[model samples]
Target: MHIVFVFRYHIFFYTRCSIPFFTNDTFETQGRRHEVFVNKTIPMVVEGDDMSAYSQCEIYKTSLNTSYSALNMPPSNTSTEQCNKWVYDSSVLKDTFITQANLVCKRVIARANANMIYFSGKMTGALVLGLLSDRFGRKKVLIISTLMHVGGAFGSAFATDYIFFVAMRFIIGVSCTGMYSSSFVLGMELVIPSKRVAASYMLDMAWCVGLYILCFLAFVTRSWDMILLVMASLTVLLFVCLWIIPESPRWLKSKGRFIEANAVILKWETINGKKALTDTSSSKNTKDDIEPESVLKMCTIPNLLIRTLLIYLNWFVIIMVNFGISLNVGNMDGDLFVNFAIISSMEMLAYTFCFLLLNKTGRKRLLVGTLFFCGGACILSVFVMLFFDKSLYWITLVLSYIGKFGITASHSIIYVWSAELFPTKVRNSGIGTSSVVGFAGSMTSPYISDLGKYVHGSFGEVLPQVIFGACSVIAGMTSLLLPETNGKALPETVFDAVQFGKKKADDRNSRLNCFYTNDAFNKDELTGEV
Candidate 1:
């Protein structure tokens, strides 16, 4: 399924940044590169007399000529937190983006910004690439996007500076949007509506698996460059596998390319050992009779617009809470790898919960319930941190995990809800718009988490929590306004979407009235005959 490929890219995007956490190396020589570590009694000379032997070089040339003694280095007095150079076991060797760019202490914001730029690119890409998929074709756009992903990953591995690394990450972000949006639309169009929830869960599982794999890879490699290179290499397999997949028949039909669509269907028929049932000419005539409307018309329909606004807010809240929790967890006081692994693993539970409950509870109930749960957990976490003793820190951790679980579930369920809400003519565009709005939340979340640390010590850490909890509550309540689409057929036009819920309500009332009237008539007839 195309979901699998897009899911791989999604996993890669989220997990790649965690590599720098383990791989950051403490500079053995903290200050200028030319500064040599030696015993205090021994004054090593490079090119000058004893008086000015170790004086700072005016030329600032290579430091290879200077004699240094790392073994007799000064005893460490400063804590690792305050020290410019950190002391680690000599056996642990790594090369990472943080170490290469020296992004520690004051420069740590650059690390977060790298993530920010990527989401920003995703926001832009969703709008641009979604339209491209509609105008050109899903297959063509997917290939182009996948190639870009491959190229960006390869380029990022060879980055010489933090700026270049961020730039490449942005490029990768854009490519991922293209691949994800195009492939998701293609896959959903091909599958029957009943199977969409299962398909979504499978893709979500694949994404979770990617994070688990990332954890193992980081443990073994312990080098950012190698990890990135390995991740990039795997995308090549996706590229190769894409060759055998057919263009989406729905997209082809929408574009009036019936011949190509028929051929693709025939290919599937041959594989399944079944005969073709429909003539291409007849299918073409049926499709041609219904003219496709402009995607922009989504804004003009009142009912569609109202529902779209709810979706937009829903997406924004989901992503804000999702990334807000994820980024904040890394900064929590704990083993970085352990924290990251725990957070990543929680997504599996969240998605699984949605899978089990989505059909039974329906989309509206699940989304609204999860959002309220997530918000309550977040607010509770803030109180625990403020009022509880230090020994009860575990309680705070527990609440954070619980909050993440609820938000993660909401994130997974929203995907299915948004897909079901839109009509066929504007589905991709509508989803793309919501995606851009959601990524905007992601783009801002890094800065919010970053600011939370400063607020934690000085301002009670309530600012970020207030924002997170409030957004969750508001978005959840707004969700009640949207229609439930459980077991309903996909709509074909804006008009169908507008009347979908009203029609359901009318049908239920009509059936109930008909039943009562028939019962009364039968009773009257029985009495007269007796």
Candidate 2:
């Protein structure tokens, strides 16, 4: 089959100054003040100036130039060619990525082994980067994480022995986790709240796109070592991208670089073609409104702790299942590259569907649905293996893929939920904690890979399958009683999420009844105010 090929990658970047601590909030006239994910519409005060304001103070500009295949970073054999030529020979580059299906799969296993450890770092990164961003600014942290990720990727690719590879992979895991958390936090925090959900979703989609590209590479490349090199080389371009992006302006003011913050906001607004809020004059005197509480204390707020813990558990499980199935596809006699690619395709669909339905379905329902789907699939997997020869292998393969789909959806959306749960003070803390847990899960994936080694043939794999199935069940059950966040705003205190969907239903109905009332018989009442 002819594959339509594409790839998505980000260049490395960093904050120029130290991230500042948030204190005065006078300049953020925007609604919704959750840290990590804040209101995107009314523009949060950055450097004490109107963030969305397009003009007035002008030291910079926020412009997004998406140059298509500009540098054409592909495999060594393929040279930069025309778009049509590239498309026709799409399989060429993709094959390079997959030449070592066994190798790639093994490396994926190796990567997952470090995943749990890596995820642990992610959780810790929120506080570290948050503090760093607030003290120095986002740009520098971004750069640091990006370069580190590149180093890790290349490091793992070139390591001479299994131990070195594992250690480097762990380092790669750290870089990835840190980069993922920092980039995501920065992206959402900088965007308008209205833009947040979509932007956040887009960020995940980029990873999916990256996977798609990886699959294509798998199809094209036959060499494992070169594939690693190609993957590592893909990120080197981030160095050039650093020239365009800037520091997190909010972090600047938090760090007392009031003028720099204001200047940054003014530049962003200019690129977006928006006028300053209430005149440019208010920009000069604005400051952050932050308390002195530590990130951990922020997490201890009421329901926040419970929600974060459960969510982390859920994250840990999902990552396990997601990578577990992918890494062990060989046990099922499935083509690792094609199966991995197909599974990723399904994940893309799952995420898209979830994003569309998330607000309408409520977090609890969506989350539960995912867990149930995954659990059900895993439970069915045992049957498929038991009946492997009777057309059941195909069914099992598809079933396992579905399990991946469900968990991927949950994994993708959980970050948004975390962002909403905590207040500005501990928003990063909560997310960081969850990230650490999630990364921990990823780290543990490698060890789980060993599960396949113990299992012999058809019957041998049953234990692994059964364990995976049961884990899903537990995760699903845990989700059943957890809080559901839907249309309602993210709660500031832990107590807010404790009530779950009940609160959202009541609040939603009240608001609708009052504002969107059926006017058939209440024409007079409706016009009373007028």
Candidate 3:
């Protein structure tokens, strides 16, 4: 199941970064804001002005009969016209949909729009399919989502029209969310409490491995369509494994499907060489007495409102910062493929460290620490870029990578922590809701990365980093309010979730009072009080 899930996860990052519009540089005409070609250099006029330095969208409406000497001078009173045709630089990225569709200048927003639409689809899927999983079964939703994902991937690969391509990306986004949320919940439920953290880290590590595979595929194929086709073809393998994976016994038991749940447990016991439970009569084939709770219950229920909001905020901030840096890889000073590969590798390194330290440090402290570290690194990079020379740009890049490492670790920790915070009955719903909120961050990330181009000077280069840094720091401070969930059993009900951190707080208060009373008594004895 992990292997299959990893294969499916490969599409997520590829979809985010595969678009060439974000990476390709546009060519502008000299002294003009309009009419320009990409990649192809225009002949320079004798007046020391490069024609390529004109407006990207405007061009002088000059006649062929105009003398070469006139071309040397700026067009005085000559009408400027919008550029009708565009050619993109094909040196780094060849045969991309962006070039094929000519999405440049005024049409460039379409690229960001496509990505936003994809994330919106993911947001929709998280809210809808997450509830469906809790109401139906995880395995059922997983299979259905897997089918949708495969179809979407295929559709994206073969889409000829821009509208069709964006529509297909939307489907891929939604289906990917459904597949991940369902599979993640099921995997978490199957693991014992002691190893749940380890299980969550392993799943994320698999996701990183999938990213590595994606980088390799992108390097080899170098075409968006071919990469999609290849990944889609490989996704078919998940169906084979899906057949063998069992429905989560925890979910089954929570729904009061005891007969099926017990059967699954018995199989596990048998495999482990333990005697099966002989009291089969106790396993009644009936629904649970308690009604299933919806994700909305978290919002309406007074005890859960604050915690839910905090989790949602953390999700939004982490995702925004992480994807903000990731999607902006092209703007960095290095080979695009190598930079992407390095970013992906950083995630793997983060997961490795997360797996090693998660159990030891606990969830809350680790999340807070990583968020702060990421925030500090990002802000420090901005300072370096602002105060230092261009030669020191490499230092900025290294700081940014460090920031990426911190955020990636925080991302992993938050996933495990958020899952632990929710109850089993509404776990998928809770996670789905948080993910839906997070997608909003993902949607805005591209535009945030583009902020550098709009702003002027070195500050422009560091603007996105500044925003990401501030958000991370704020989120880290906010995370301190969330309770730690280490070596604790998964919550099985709303009440359990409500009381998760309160009990520990109460215990600490009682202990403090006890210590004060004992100290007073000792002082009285020393003073010879009766």
Candidate 4:
């Protein structure tokens, strides 16, 4: 059930980012004409420059008879006027909101603004829905979010007005955050600690599958509205499946609903063909009187503050770099669909590798390694693009994929690592807060990617890549301060989280003391023997 929900949610959530690429069309000034009757004072041989023939934003008032000494010369006695109409090339894209609403030239910023608006909605949902899930139950929020998601998707599909479409996208973004965060927390809580790494990998694989499905859907439909309608229709099945899924037992226990928690566990055991313990004694051991901690406690507590800040930074960097690279698919020199599909496949491989190494290498070490690897790839790709010839463009693509692989692995690890770091009492809230910060990273990525277009020459091409790579490196170094969470039980309370790393620190100190003592004794024994 969790797998189905994740798979469908990703399809709905990620498709928005890819829509702009299909909808974007090359356009030229409308009603452009040359006056043939104007007198030419001088005659010269001319060569036509097709590239400079037409303006995208402005129309030039000039005569075809204007005198020019050479080809590619600016039209003499010409005045510029802002074009009110445009003729979009519909050869590639049959129809799009950009063409329909005329979002070209000066209005092009609206496209990036729309993406930012959606991410802002995601930020809001992370905070509000995350808190709601912790205060209410994950199941209730998940159900509500599913309905919201479907409604928003349908709204987006049928929207005629550009503003209306943007609004629907925002709603979809908000609902997607709610659905993902609630479902992820619920899924994590349902499983035992030992199996969490595997479960996380499974969820990530589901996401990859959704990406593949999206690529196919986009290819088949070729229309953004049709694609949305199909995906929304398919997502309805997840809502139906949610009816049979149970709430998190861990959440029930955290809220002091031991009877409910035990009931859920007993059902699981019965389904697995094991004898269920009828004893209520285990419930009595827990302190039902203890109140669940709020996310604010993480900020106030000295022990948790640094950890929380560090995790937030990691979340920000991972999301920024990941989305930054993913959104650049359209700008890459190749088939857009093929590039997206290849990147999705790379993500699947990364998840597989991460699953295999997670336990052996531990979370912190693996995360740091992947981040550093991604950063190195991103930085190297820039140099390749700048210094190397165009013939080596394929090498740049390979390096970009390498960066994708590293970030994909890091993305998988962070989800499991952050979940284990936060206590059950405020786990949803903690993740939600981190997600809020992460969404900000995503919000900025579209503009960062647009930097390539605003800047000229090779430097413009590699500027975004350089920024992403630098951030990844900085994040990797900062992550070194985070404690390893592999093989550790999920922290259950604020107190438990506060003490999470203390035992390891103590053990290390003890080992050092023993080593020094043994050395001193060996030195005395050697002196006596002499």
Runs in model 2 with CA error above 4 Å? 1-135, 161-164, 249-261, 276-288, 299-302, 387-390, 445-460, 480-530
Superposition TM-score, candidate 3 onto the true structure: 0.83
Better of 1 and 2 by lDDT: 1
Residue 321 lDDT (model 1): 83
Instruction: Write down the TM-score of every candidate.
Output: 0.76, 0.64, 0.83, 0.82
The predictions' CA RMSDs to the true structure, in order, are 11.0, 23.0, 10.0, 10.2
Quick one: RMSD of model 4?
A: 10.2
Q: 1 or 3, which is superior by TM-score?
A: 3
Judge candidate 1 at residue 184 and give its lDDT: 77
Error of 2 at 231 (Å): 1.9
Encode model 2's per-residue lDDT on 360-475: one tens digit a residue.
77667787788778888877878876765755567877887788888788776677766655543345555666666665665565565566557656565577667667777788
Tell me how far the alpha carbon of residue 310 in candidate 3 is from the true structure, in angstroms, after superposition: 0.8
Indicate the worst ten consecutive residues by lDDT in candidate 2: 8-17
lDDT of 3 at 440: 87
Off by over 4 Å in 4: 1-53, 62-76, 276-289, 452-461, 504-530
Q: Evaluate model 2: give its lDDT.
A: 0.54
